[model samples]
Target: MTTTGAVLRIQLLGPVRAWRDGAETALGPPKQRAVLSLLASRPGDVMGVENIVDAVWGSDVPRTAVNGVHTYVAGLRRALEPGRAGRSSGAVLTSESGGYCLRVDPADVDVTLFHRALHAARRSRGQGEAGAALRLYGQALSYWRGEALSAVPGPFATMERDRLRDLRLTVVEEWAADMLAAGHHAELVTELPAAVSEEPLREKLRWLLILALYRSGRRAHALWLYEETRDLLARELGIEPGADLRTLHEHILTGHPELLAPGAGSPLPVYPGGLPPGTPGPVRLPPVGRDFVGRTEELARLEEVMRGESARGGPTTPVVVVGGTAGVGKTALVLQLAHRLVDRFPDGQLYADLRGADPERGPASAAHALEQLLGGLGVDGARVPADSAARTALYRSLLRGRRVLVVLDDAHSAEQVRPLIPRGPSGVLATSRRYLGELAARDGARLETVGPLTAREGTRLLAMLSGRRLDERGPAAERLVALCGGLPLPLRVVAQWLAANPGAPLGALLEQHPALRTRFGPAEAADGVPTGQFHVIETS
Candidate 1:
């Protein structure tokens, strides 16, 4: 297919509308718009008829789905390439290998242009040209008019809408951060409140707005806004303001000079990966087990979510809560994920034991956790704040503009985790016995539930840890895996036992140590064991 001289401009950042040669093209019915929406999502990629059907109709597909797609394509072809003659193969929307491909100049598509502008903005920001970055960010964000793909009916449209909306929000936050860094707080004071209203739960937005208000000499209003935000978060999400907001409030209250100084704070950092060699920063991550295995999906998901903050070039911190029953490897999974993401966060990695579920001492207070985190960040113990809120504020202030990964282990509640969340482009990986739903609802945290490994994974872990060819043991290994309930703690303990008792067969080991059997009894064994066969024998 050859490209026509005329350009077809498709806008998917907002309502799925299109224009050809500066003329508005009437996209047909909702389903047809959905077809175009899907095609436009992956502009050059070929979408098979079956794939289109699945995306458009979801599960309730009709027998005539293929024909419906063909009709939609025919309609789109007519609208997109009006000059094409009748009964002719489409020049723009061409059929290829039993699928359809939408060929268009990427610059003509709003989404592509938006991303290009974002890339340029990111580059400018990286080079410390805050003005140029802000201009580029504004240009990129101007493409968004309303909810993306609005009223376009299809599963694909719904998902794409959500994705594009999130991207727009990220760009907006980055733009505001740049604006603030450029000392344009007076302008943002009137503007950011609406954005905050639209995304009330976004702490980054609230943080920027509060900062703008404070810098605009509206310290009282900023303090009032913090109280309002606190009350709102408490009422809606049952949580307190996150570290960033709390820190800003403290600065406002204490009349911190940094808040009032020119060049108030630098723009958020944009490190692609590791910092240069000899960039000294604390690496406090706990060593992960050498025999760590499984949770491939969970780990991948965590990395994706954590990296997504930087990938979007936004100032929002990514907080991920890894939750499950005790002894199910929540902390292990978080530590593994943190170790994997260390290079991505160039500032450093910080770890703290909240001891939320510790038997000897109850959950560590937020103040103590903040002190530990601040000390890990190289803040002297003597200089740490005496007040809890002041400590949280100071901790977040230290984290601002730095790409650090703060791993909060065994968190007791959302409140405990909230004060510890890092600010700016940093990331947080928190493990908790409780679900900590408030983090997700209030902080935009991604909740990942860590569970026991599958039988195959357990067997692999055992084989790796014990230096045993457990695959050779077949049903006995399977029985042991079931008996361990696939939890890492019990499996590691048994693997260690087998490592010590080298030649003991798996069945004989079970017979020889009745205490081991009692501890890791059958999956149905009840006493002290939680549901899902979680023994709760020890802390993760």
Candidate 2:
């Protein structure tokens, strides 16, 4: 576990050591190590300098303790990064307004990963994927070698250790539940009683042991185990078993078939029609219309707006709005651009589907979108305001001074996006079917209009989608491109149809769907204007 680029490997069950690269790095007396450990435990959160000083020196800190804290952070960074040549951008420790944050990747920390995996397992169980839930729960439990933060000696260390121990016990209960769901009652008979012994106060664990015993045909032992646990709880804690546990005991006594139902013996609590509890990745969008083809130049231009030289000249709060007709690839271009520039905003990248201008639903309220964005940024539910104006104000306030990238996809108009625009030195990219002229004039946002793909680009796009050499197919590819009207969405749809229907001929496809020709428009340009028509292909 490294904190702020410093390689720190701690074995609470054994020795604790800090290293820089391959060499041992001393943690400047012992007080400094305690301060570093506390900060590392909560990554990405700003810890005030004064609070850190007080933590390390307690009431005995000198008048210059604040300066000492700075020196300690600087030393820790140097130790973590060695000569500093390999220091990552933002490093492990970063300075914010009135404090500093440890920016360690959560995956690199064992405790963090353990908690995350445990949460994932519980969620999987809720989703009715018992096999996946069991695997995840087992993997989470495997991370525990011994007591957490064991080698570290301090009040904070003791508190953290106890917290982790409790969390581990909760995970153990989840594990037993997953095992029972997987129909391993006989195997759990031996395992669950030992777990109950380790965590005697937890009624849930005791309940699981009784259920496992009853299912394994040890009825007398199961009842005896329940009595023993109830007596211990009453004597030690002056409390009765929880309602769930008592209910399970009574069901076992009555020979209820529920006790024999698959997964009934598990102690996993059920959520009340809520989303599964776990760390979920971003939602993936399904493939929209495949008629989309070509537009290489437009794609490149949008890329330039995001990462090219043109993007730098915009206002401090740069805005790039892509507009086009329905099915014109505005959202596609914006999505592609955002994916490419994800690394640019190390702070974070945010995306929202405003669903504005959609055929089914009217435009989403600015206040609603603001609420979603605020929630995504870790704002507590109670802290979010109810009013639109207040929400917008709070959203902008939160965004101020942060270098984040915001993508509002499928917006209705500039009016819908204006209030949603965050202030400060951030970048805002929006997509709309309508040309937002006022946004360009007032907000100095650049507008990029996506047009139909060129003939060659359209052919290439079809070739890419079909996974075949279009040149080998000759006039058929050209005819198909022209038939699709050089529209990417249509071309993709036709290509998918062709790919799926492998035995069909391109000529037959064109002959049966002559309407495609009219959809592509005329071949020749009228006057000096280019023909908007391209060759058409049957999609529906």
Mark the regions of model 2 whose C-alpha exceeds 4 Å error after superposition. Answer: 1-296, 299-315, 380-383, 467-473, 517-540
- Highest TM-score, which number? 1
Q: What is the per-residue lDDT of model 2 for residues 269-304, given as tens digits with 9 covering 90 to 100? A: 311111112323233333344434455677677667
The superposed Cα distance between candidate 2 and the true structure at residue 426, in angstroms, equals: 1.4
> What value does the lDDT take at residue 508 in candidate 2?
77
lDDT of 2 at 533: 45
* Backbone clash count, each prediction separately: 1, 23
| Superposition error at 126 for model 2 (Å) | 57
Best by lDDT: 1
> What local distance difference test score does each model get?
0.79, 0.66
